[model samples]
Target chain A: MGGDFPRGKSAIAGLATFGVGEAPGFSSMELTARAALLAVEDAGLRIDAIDALFICQPDDFFAGLSFAEYLGLSPRFTDNNRTGGSAFMSHIITAVMMLEAGYIDTALIAYGSNQRTNGGKLATSIKPNSWDAPYRPLFPLSSYALAAARHMHEYGTTREQLAEVAVAARQWANTNPEAFAKGPLSIEECLASRIISSPISVRDCCLVTDGAAAIVLTRTDRARDLPRPVVPVLGAAAATWWNSIAQASDVTTTAAAESGPRAYHAAGIGPADVQTVQLYDAFTINTVLFLEDLGFCPKGEGGRFVSGGTIAPGGTLPVNTNGGGMSYCHPGMYGLFAIVEAARQIRGEAANQLGKIDVALAHGNGGTLSSQATVILGSADTL
Target chain B: MDGMTGGPEAQWRAALADGRFLLQRAISSGTVFFPPRVMEPGTGETDLEWVEATGLGHIYSLTWVSQKPPVPPYNVAIVRLDEGAQLMSRIEGANPETLRIGQRVRAKIGTQDDGAPILLFEPTGH
Candidate 1:
């Protein structure tokens, strides 16, 4: 993979978003088209300049081809590889490979959903024959709560540690006007919140808002020509261990165990070099798992590492600087938001900008801790 | 084993109706899998057979769906079956939050909303 791009690898040229909250009357296709156009505009390119496209959606009705048709794009390459929340991060790696191979010049990856305003449920309508239907597993959250319970049993992870994740995210969210969580959150309030699942309170879960995001990727040289500061795609990797929680070989450890190290190695750096981390926080346990599996701390010590406001606004490691899914906007699949936030950090344009930041790492978790994708991004100075 | 025609799913479902839990084991590799499948996961061997499990296991993990549910505040659990297979089932007659990991559980035949046979678990102590 290193030899494939000895010099001038792919870089993120533009990033754009739409409707962090309540885009009433906009269908998923409409949201997708608007996001794609905004990304191309941000890239300082015409909509027709895009030669490749990718779209992620919660439903199959709004397919990638339909989005292309709606956007009037006849791109040479297209993909709808939906890996839940990890889809967009996975797309960055796929786009990199295609850009290096000259299969496509400008790749546009976008996602949009009205899951909130549309009143959509995640898996209530899963195929009637699913093994999970009878037991009534509450979509993804229950499965994650179960994993959190196991982690607590094995590592003595306390409920307060989980509440801290929500508190830190709220602190970051309070800084961003676009964040859904409007006020400061206290650990006491987080612990007192209603429990959606045992061991996972409402605060521990992400916001169910409507939103969309997009990114433009091209070769490094091509990115230099774009309007915004070029953020090089230092590294990107993806892994999937299982689709269902019941079948997961090990629930405590996720695919991040594989993708995290691979992404770091591809970037020729390690976790310590990352100034800020944009990790998936669909649930508090997700942050806990990624921190440990990504080697930020010794395995099972994530509870200790995250205590004492370690990941809060002024903490040593600023994670989910844009309030993350917990406090920010989690329209649905949150993978793209991590990349969007990482790019913002690299470009020094984040709403809650951190000091002395050069390298940012974005990690995504999909399904019931089933799929994982890690992306490493750096400022032009690092490039 | 060579003539195993119909997939193991139907057989397993049928066993649930008869108050027995069925698991599939790879005849060659001796690997056990729940929610039975046709071929072994890694080896892709079709030499699979249905075996009656001890219908007993310990809770590996559990969660209470406090939200709207088929039953208010029901317990969902992943039980490590005695046959070395793990599957998700509902536990009856136990406090959701009070349920402890590693507590012993036993399989019991149950019916879903449509009266379709399914596997569930309950605390052996209860």
Candidate 2:
């Protein structure tokens, strides 16, 4: 795979988010359409200018066709790949490829979900294996719990270390005005929270909120004329190892180990060059797992690396500067929001914006640490 | 029920009713996998054979799921069998909070709500 084909060739021209915290009276389609329209307008482009559409709607069957019909667009190319939350991150790579290959000039990647409003009933739940379903594990959650338990057992990662992830996210959330859970959070509070699954408390999980996010992508040359600062797609890659945690070769590690290196290689940069990171933190353990897998620290050293406000505000390496899904908002699929925050950090428009981020990394995780996708975005100066 | 069926899952379920644990092994790669499939994973080779499991394994990973009032919490675990095949099951005859990873376990058949036999594990007490 020529991973560098789209490096610095494609750029995100516009980004928009709607109904992030709560969209009580809106449908998922409505949320998606509104965000799509806003994203087009943000780029100073009309609705009809979007020649390519990439959408992943968990609640809708044939999501691409349905979204096209709802938004009244006849795109020349479309993709509705559903790799869980990471689908949008993977879409960024696809959009870049389409733009570079001359298949489409403008790509609109979008996602929306009303899981919170629907009482947390996800229309598409990750189906456990037949042998595992009989035991009635609380899917997705239990899978992560198992990984956390194994991580603790094999590497001596303490619960306090795990709780630090939540504390850090909450600290960042306090500064983000659009964050849903701006209230103070402490490692003590996290440790004392009721256990939803062993080794993972209710506090360890992400907030369920109704939200939608969309980003408009075009060639870097065309992006020069767009309204916002051009955040070019420097590199992108994705990988999947297993469908269920039981089948995973190593529960403690994720496919990010594969995707991260490939993405960094494609971008012609290493982890040290990344000023900030936005990882898909569906659970506290997720951040720990991704940090280690993405080469932020040595393997099995993530727990120690995140301790003592390292990833918190004023930390060494700013992570989840937008509060992340754990505090900001997680509407079923969160990859789009991760990309949105990465762009925000690069554009110096994040609620908790860092200082002059030249390069940012946005990584997405899907299923039970199953699918992993890494996207490296950089400002014009890097190119 | 007779242990006779055209599909792998049916055969496995019938064997469970008779209190026997079975796993599929790929003939080409000599690799064992769970949730009996028609073809081996990765290679997709249809040449597969059923073999008796050792009924002894260690807990590779585990989690205790807490429920609302009146519903007791249950343990969900992944057991790595001695034959090198791992599966998802529950540890019986022990408190979930007291269990630890790498603890030895022995397989036992348990019945589900509809009287369908399910494979479970209990502490080996070593």
Candidate 3:
């Protein structure tokens, strides 16, 4: 074992294109379609070459759309899956399975939500249609606020450390032209934003935007003929939690804590070998929690490690080169953006290119921090 | 499939109301269920009954939302009642400002004007 994790495929070639649809640019659907078109163009192929399509599921209230008919996609094998924010990266794992099984030739995965349309006001929080009742959406900010509180109580991590994460994200956003929360964000500002849940302010939450992003994947053979360099899937994994918050073994650790190691082993690489990373940032705490859970640093050291400027621009690993969901465009399934950005940087095409990245890590999660998917990408076509 | 009472909106309101909540289901093949139904979720068993619980449970998990939750930062938690039934409820007694997990919480009963007896949980100060 090179480090600790598993080694992935030697060569599984394919071109995965990502399109961010947000802000002064376009609506969720409009942006999704545009990205699909552009990805096809980037692959030097026609849209018809896309035999399969998977969409990041959006709540009916967010995008005002439901499943079935794939909304505008006419793919021979089109389907939409709604797992959570991690649904985007989870699609990549599914795509790899389809490719290996030879289910279809080319596939495209798209995620779009008019977070701005709903203004992030997801309809009823209570279970709907089912025997479950209804209530205004009482989402993660509060849910996560609880978890963060427990973490602080158990580990004594300071709220200032959490504020640091928000501050860092806004800092990265400043460098990102398309970032929704870009520019300077003071600690006082983060501390001042209306508290959504205990310990979490409005600024602590991700930005809601009307946007859609897509990633196109083809067989290794077909990807070789594409215009831009193709990044291969070295390894992938996923996991889910038990019942509600009460059933979880640990509140601070997310499903990623379980999935990250599995993906690493499958890829035959350890956390230390990952040159760059794309940790899903639904909340700043998630970033720090996964940082430790993914083995980037020791547990509970997430606050200290990050406080030392480890995830910043000049740090050992530069995350969310695209500014991440916190600053970039969350749009619900912000995880997909993480996967796309990792691939871009590995391909040396990222706007915020870091050092020569040989391998990259992309971790995405869904549900109430319930589901997780971890993926590994490489700079070379074949390992 | 059990039907919603008053409506989805009302049921949730009832669920959140004090002493106005009660969920019961017969035990078969093990496991407590809310809203007694004739058919199981996966088995479709036509053997189900509704039974009133003792309405006493331990706080399984607790979270202290800073301000009111986006919806209302009140106490939201899963209480595993003594009767082996777990339900979501808003808690009181402890400050919403300093609630802790694994604390002893007792269910308090009250009635809504609509005559529905609401159930709420509060810290036993233990």
Candidate 4:
């Protein structure tokens, strides 16, 4: 993300930031209300302005009703873009598309589920798809297993480097009370944290806590009359490979390789322009894989790029500043939060802000290791 | 758990003959969903209708997995079928030596013990 592109305050006239919301992990309804209220309050708009509704959680036990009826979202455009973890971003991407096509403005994107409070039964009972329901790969854990095995087999990546990503996120999480994976998780502790999948341990996986977050996207003309006068959708792109985990061409690469370029081009920037990055970390391998796929480093060198505190706080391109999904709370809501954090960082409001507020990248992964979506956010000055 | 060959066996074979292994869902206007979903993705309606894929496709990208992966190494790829649907499946029936980007492939039904079918792509020899 290099170059100070052209951007004006008018370009983001309708932008606003809904205060990030979390709820008492009782049920999906509570999380929904929690996020909706924050979004409503943050935008300084009434709950009724949301003309578009998108939800990633498409299961009954979580939402307590069919999506449309459950949320009471009476929007013209609706999407439960369940591309996977990035479903939230997919929802946001859909909103942006609708806005560009003049489909609708003032859309509300929300995601909330309880793996911790709900006894983790919703995920276990609900099968991902017809092909996978039978196999029932532990998903994030097993999918990371595929990448762990590939990285170890191919690039001579050690277990320690992968652990570093988790460790760094935890260290940063201590500053943010909402993060689930806080506390000092030394490499030794991580190495011993119950091998969920080979080369990756329990801590390497996202926590099962329940939380909800919502963002309000309005027409550029309407953002000026909001709580946050800035923070607009700068650029977004999505890419998908066939979703056969076992049949992927390269475990180390991802659809981000394709999506990242498109997003950068749309934003009129390059990888180097990003000051912060919020990579989806349902598993450490994804964070690691995307570091390369998004052009942070050359292919097959993600392990190296992440080593030696390059992505840690006070390091070059400090990533996952708000603890990411690994330490933040993976509850499948990390995509929205990651984008939220990137927006927050671009606005210079993160707990661990590093450099000048310019460009930030948020990448989300979905469907076994195949689908990917990337969005680039930048400041008006740098735009 | 391993795949067994039984009742899921017979029905799967017949479905393969009928070319029912091809999946269609609402997730996209692009390709078949390998793992079928009850809903047509983007549409909340449970309007998922199964349709037979064109079965004819070109090799968009490929790799020769040298050894067993989680199960063992095998050839895997993203095949762009004539319907413009991209599917990721094991590339069987052709030697790795002769694989090319534009290689024509035929959809093959892989049957398991329980009579369920798994679709795998194989290169159609010229």
Provide the clashing-pair count of each candidate structure: 0, 0, 24, 26
* Residue lDDT tens for model 3, B1-126: 166465434554555453344544445755555444445545776565444465667766555454443544556665667766555566765665466666777877755466755566787767
- Residues A1-383 of candidate 3 have per-residue lDDT tens digits of 33232233222232333334344444556556666677667778777677777775565433313322334445556556566777767677776677667787788776665556554554224332222112112565555665676677677777778877777776667776666766777778887777666666777677776666667787665676777676777888888884344445577787777788888877777998988888788887788788888998888888777775567677666766677878887776687778778887787877677857789898887766678888888865445
Compare candidates 2 and 4 on lDDT and give the better one.
Answer: 2
Ranking by lDDT: 2, 1, 4, 3
Q: List the residue pairs that clash in candidate 2.
A: none
DockQ, per-model, please? 0.80, 0.85, 0.28, 0.07
Mark the 10 consecutive residues where model 4 chain B has the least summed lDDT: B1-10
Docking band of candidate 3: acceptable
Among the numbered candidates, top DockQ falls to: 2
Put down candidate 2 lDDT per residue, A82-143, tens digits, no spaces.
Answer: 78889988999888988899989999999988878877676565578777899988878999
DockQ winner between 1 and 3, please give it.
1
Residue runs of model 3 more than 4 Å from their true location after superposition: A1-27, A59-74, A117-137, B1-61, B64-73, B78-87, B97-99, B111-117
lDDT of 2 by residue, B17-123 (tens): 88888899998899988878899987889998889888999999999999896788889999998888888899998786578899999999999999989899999
lDDT of each: 0.84, 0.90, 0.66, 0.67
Candidate with more favorable, higher TM-score: 3 or 4: 3
* Consecutive 10-residue window with the lowest summed lDDT within model 3 chain A: A128-137
> A159 in model 3: Cα distance from truth in Å?
1.2
Model 2 chain B lDDT-worst window of ten: B1-10
